[model samples]
Target: MDTQIGCAIKASNELVKNLHRDGFDRGCIATFNDYMTTFTKNKASLHRSLNGINNAKNGTRLYDSIVDVIQIFRNRGEVSRPWILVVVTDGDDNISSRSLHKCAQETSSLFTTKESNNFLFLVGVGDGVNSEKMNEMASAGNFIYIHAKDFFLLELIFLKIANKITTSLSLSLGNLTVGDHSASWAEVQRHRNLSKVAIDYALLIDVSASMNSRVISSNSVTNLNSVITHATRAIGQSFDSRIINTTNVALLASWIDKKRGNPYNFSDLPFEFKLIHRASRDGFGNDKFHNNCDNKGPTIVVIKVKYSGEIIGGYNPLEWRCVKINEWSTLLPNNHDFYIDQQRRTSKSFIFSLTNQTISRVTLNNDAIIWSRNKGPCFGLQDLCITNNFGKSEQRSYENRIINKKNFEIEEYEVFQVIDKRPRFSIFYFIFMIFMGIFKIIKFIFMRLFLGIYWTCYIVYWIIYWITYWTVITLICVAGIGLIVSILALPIILYLYLEAEIAWVILSALFIYAPILGLIGEYLVI
Candidate 1:
């Protein structure tokens, strides 16, 4: 939905011309066509108001353009049945002759300041756009802009808009229901008809109090999850969970909650760092693991390596550390912009290597992880370029010199997975999860087989304890399942029940937990 503003103007000109040739009333449409032609041809000298701004000869004359467009609405009304005017730039108000404050004040009048899906929709294109200013210019759904790249993407935006205005561009053969709406587009090509992709993801967002108060859009459910999963998969990473394979990835999720002026903090981060209570639950640490992260409790087990290091991650610049989980893991404020030089910072964290101090785009799927959405994680004025060298390092682990923050020195750590016989996080990730899973199995099996008051009750209680552990169990888990056995105090409890030969207690435990413990133990084996 993004294209350069000028490109949009060009698109409008073409569409109107076609409509005029198609025998549609050319009076009001003609007015827009003429204004656009003048703006494009004599752009240097054109003092325009078609874009709702005055003297928009340079970039700043939107006031006049807006006035001109609004005039057409007044004369004809109904805006010729659904036209669009998208502002495709960061509203820096740099090239404008009018001050932003003045433009903002006047622009609010261009469209009815209500959310009734009336008037023109204002879409701020690039990070430079003053969203507030854009909001003032917009009436409702009509005012939206797509951030432009080279002219290619702009052209796509125009085509998409044309399709939207004319007919339904996207159609679902699947069991989707776009009920009681429009039919289909006349000229629409049924290309990009995706039947299936390798990966499918479902993000069960935790909309709890401890988490962000933002809600994922019902409209975007199917597409958003698919897009996000695909985006992650394209980087050879996994989704449906949080795992940072490499810091090189340009990470982004729905930052809409932040855009809606919602709360942001790490306490609300949907995922936790602790290893799962069950062995196999290691972030799906199976061969299917797309990304890599140490399941070890959030510890600063930094490794200094003499070779290439891959495991790299930084707090998302948009995310903040929540309350301290430990000496190592602390809560990050949902808002990192406070310490940032620019309010519109892109990426959750400022990465190194761009001359412009912007978070460098993470290259994946043979395409750089460029952003199309603009919200909490959108780029800022200072973040347009990469901060420093990108791709200088590869993987983090032993077999290669890794810089352990704890030691502040490059050293070796166990290679969980093997890449060139070097300990890379991706491989390490699978190994760690598998190892933990196996350990859990052995523990559960032994606990059930040996500790005999109740095979199910004792094991079930132990597994739940492992899952609910709020304190220091990660370091303990890796050591072995033996520790879990000791920590839960199962043998002692089992002995008490058995010694008492308490018929009521035995029946109570069975009614409550025999099946549960059996399941937990079997789960480990599975």
Candidate 2:
């Protein structure tokens, strides 16, 4: 045993005695059973019973020491710190009148439940110690039976207990709200090429008269072609200016035909003769905006596709002038409308910002301009691949399709605010995930169970419920068809195959399940 621990116990006892309180005070110890035996200090004491039972005061000594400490907070409301009982025993309390179980149970219950008792620590030393009984008296992780012999090791343990009782922890909450003065937003790009394929991008800027004024001066672009040229090169394949001409970039302008004064002719359409913010016949390209600040919010002006013709999901085309600012739309009157016709697409009602806000903005519903090349023949919907700076353009040689060899870091968007948040999908997302996992496991077990004498009753029960209700009826029918086919097909399939006979038979038995199994019709397979 550590010398420091024994000293701490003695010192703690002294400090506890001087404190004044009743209910607020806590600390107690009870030694019991056929294990630890405390010795008396006096040699001249005579036994009242003469058989040593009356004279043995081991239990009394422990009880007195515990009560003296517990009495400090016994009558008061509460104490500032926890009350701990440091129990050091040679072995089990064999000489005590009470059983070890009773001692462990009642003592622990009283001190903790008592207003003064908030914390506890128990230590058992050496061989023959009743560790299980000690565990019952104290919390599992809190109770420890030291492997050393005697009271020598108390210093290290009690000091740790003292440290734990004094520390405090808390959770604090506060964040930005909508309509705050500062409206910031953010965008992300792959730090490295996610794929070695050619990278393509498009920047759609608002060439409206409002955006023509220079940042330093009121001078607007006199030449529309010059603004297009500057923007295309500014946002091309790489940020490095030296290699700008070497890269392949295509560009398109929004309201190009509208500005050209002949909106009806497709020949004089919004698309450009050269690739400036434009896509090829395949529809993959880039858009770089030299003119900054679109006071008009999120809108589609340009688009980008990659490889030969794959337009992967990236940013929303309906952003304000297709610019990446923390807060552009909510602070300004210029947000665009949704695309004309698309499925599974959300209205551009809310913009994602780097910060939160409180006030809503005003805008027109029909003002949204959609720049789509989907109508033209050269614009193959799926075939046109305008590349982004996707790095290596040759990645099809791998045998393992799931492996991504490059270390590509994507830009992470720091959530700005809670605008138009969907609570319905949020609440059930976790539940849906958990249900799918359990369903998969149950299906696996059922498949294995069906291979035995359990096939007929299973098939018969499913037959009844599958036709019972509308919601579940179709599911039952599907499962029934698949199940019946499996049972019938397995036998015939095995008889034809030589090497694969048993294997196909086993494989075919597990194939009779619907996407939603027992839940669909409330199955009964005993």
Candidate 3:
């Protein structure tokens, strides 16, 4: 015991030295067995006190010591510095006047304060220590519990605690080698390569000027405008980018999803493009445009200026719904005009010019898209508005004007709905999927049946096991009671009758065979 006490004191002194070296210059050391003695933060004084603890104490008052340490910290008043309390015990509490519950309450109250950073570590040493009780106390106090097999391991444990405290107090670069740094850079490059933007784009070419020209074909001179119109019609088979295979829908999807913070990788899925409304097909009526493209998710409107040959368009993330006159009136009570344009707010809206290859994002998030009953899809207050096939472009809510021309007649205008493409499956693949699903169902049923059988057998085994165990215990308890009765009666029988050899023999038999029977019963139960 004395040697054990000396080892504990030596380990504690080493811990204090290590803590002081690790920049924890000010700390309190409290030693407790039956009673506790605290030493303030002086290196020499702490060492002297630790060396003076030569004798070993008999009782362990663990709970009482914890309360005392908490009280000492509280008496220090308010402190900005971090507080760390380390409690080491070799045995369970034997002389603690303070209940475990009371000590836990004090510990919790002391540690869970916003005043300063507080840390508590409870360490149990040797096989005699009650680890479960220590764990419970640590959990209640919101501290850490550590167990050491012997007193010799305390040095390593204390050193680790000092290192932990130092690490928490300071910040430093991690253990990354040059190779690791290079590997990290390579990973970043790989991520950048994989994270390319997905896009859905349309090319609107101007062929209006070709109307006045003539083209010399292999047979004869033909009208160039007619040939051009025929080519445009052939290209306008469907707005489906996959069918066209000219524009990169993946790039557009990636860009949009990234900007909107959507985790979905649109590049993995093909885009379904449908030309909802074309001015040539549906006439240049605003009502017709809204009726066809109103509830459609996202649409791209592209216009080819008549003479300038400038191709400009805007991306509306929201559906274009015409605001009712009554709703518009309520929205803008000050406005007297019969025509009221509904301003839609969105940060994702953007306009671009194919000719200039410039994209302008909406500067003012609010009023990004405007919807009017009289005008076809309007963007940013006349930034770009189409009414009866005539379009106007003026920079207002957007960063830059996509088209220089303020007002121009659209040679051709098309609105295409941007949607995720549905996967096409072959008949064979569909049949395979059906078979796989059936197999999965069969597997699930078999697994459930197996589990049911296993649990049933397991329950039966435990039932039999408990029954045998109780029978053995009952026999051992009866034998113990009989042995006690026989011993108590033998003393009286021996004093009362001098020639009680039969009773002596019975007593000897009971003492010898009772233990043998109990052992046999224990073996059977086990």
lDDT of each: 0.31, 0.28, 0.60
Better of 1 and 2 by lDDT: 1
- lDDT of the structure predicted as candidate 2: 0.28
Q: In angstroms, how far off is 116's CA in candidate 1?
A: 12
Query: Which candidate has the highest lDDT of all?
Result: 3
In angstroms, give how far residue 74 of model 3 lies from its true place. Answer: 0.5
Q: What's the ranking of the predictions by TM-score, best on top?
A: 3, 1, 2
User: Is 2 or 3 the stronger prediction by TM-score?
Assistant: 3
Q: Per-residue alpha-carbon lDDT of model 3 for 441-479, expressed as tens digits?
A: 999999999999999999999999999889878777777
Candidate 1 clash figure, as a count? 85
Q: CA lDDT of 485 in candidate 1?
A: 48
Q: Which candidate model has the greater TM-score, 1 or 3?
A: 3
**What TM-score should be assigned to candidate 1?**
0.26
Question: Could you list the CA RMSD of all candidates, in the order they appear?
Answer: 29.0, 39.9, 43.6
Q: Local error of candidate 1 at 199, Å?
A: 40
